[model samples]
Target: MGAPAAAPFPWREVMEFGLGRLGWPPDVFWTASPHEIIAASEAFRTAPAGEAPARGVLDALMRDHPDDSGEAAEA
Candidate 1:
């Protein structure tokens, strides 16, 4: 067989997450890269009952792995 067919892009689902679930403005949604959106979407959809990270964990993570925007995407 030739190479397996490529997976379809999940455009509608991604748009709904950005525009509806996350309530990002149209301009923000349109401008966000796929990686940025995926990171935000994952952060928002994680189980609410999960134990919260200790204070400053997020800051340390950002300092260590800053995004292209110079900060982590706000979920």
Candidate 2:
């Protein structure tokens, strides 16, 4: 078999767009980790009506995937 295909969704861009809809500024995105971005996207997907985007999920992701000198996090 060859290498795995890329994800169908453009996760980073999709995440960024979600954050934008949540009233977050662009600078917040530029400085955020992938974990934070993904978490925010997920939170948005599952949030109740009239609720704001959450950072609690982002905290969980950070604990699971820490920064490693520019290395990708392991599954």
Candidate 3:
């Protein structure tokens, strides 16, 4: 047989699994509003792998989510 069909990215399952590992209430995570989820995911993705802050990622995220005036507010 050729390469097996690639598995789909089970986003919900992955998010739940990660939250469970961190001792967070997985059910509560599932119930989060879309905006809240987006914000949280952006923060998580930008955070450094270790304790260090990922300033670059944070800056990029903020830059991307600028206000209607086309300028990002100071954090």
Candidate 4:
């Protein structure tokens, strides 16, 4: 018989983080492994909130991704 499912995977907290807080498109979220999602969420939580990004970093971001609207885009 198959081993039982991992308990942590069923936890709603992880699902919400992967789907909601991360704001990943549904397909991307679903495609990511649970460990991948958790690591990203943890990194996001530990990161400093509002501080100026370096000029080069900012410039590169704008050049690579030119979107006018979206909260995530700001950071």
Worst 10 residues of 3 by lDDT: 14-23
Measured on C-alpha atoms, candidate 4 has an lDDT of 0.78
- All candidates in order of lDDT, best leading: 1, 4, 2, 3
Best by TM-score: 1
Candidate rank order under TM-score: 1, 4, 2, 3
Error of 3 at 3 (Å): 27
lDDT per residue for candidate 3 within 4-65, as digits (tens), equals 99999788665864476444586777677768766766777886667844799767877888
Per-model TM-score, in order, reads: 0.59, 0.43, 0.38, 0.49
Candidate 4 wrong stretches, greater than 4 Å: 1-10, 54-75
The lDDT of model 2 is 0.71
The model with the greater lDDT, 3 or 4, is 4
Off by over 4 Å in 1: 47-75
- Give candidate 3's whole-model lDDT: 0.70
The clash tally of candidate 1 reads 0
Q: What is the lDDT for 53 in model 2?
A: 40
Task: Evaluate all candidate structures by whole-model CA lDDT and list the values in order.
Answer: 0.84, 0.71, 0.70, 0.78
- Between candidates 1 and 3, the one scoring higher on lDDT is 1
Give per-residue CA lDDT, model 1, range 1-75, as digits (tens): 799999999999988999998899999999999899989978877857568767688777767777866755554
lDDT of 4 at 19: 77
Q: What TM-score does prediction 3 earn?
A: 0.38
Q: Which digits, one per residue and each the tens of the lDDT, describe model 4 over residues 1-75?
A: 999977664657766877788888889988998689878978988888887889998889886776765434544
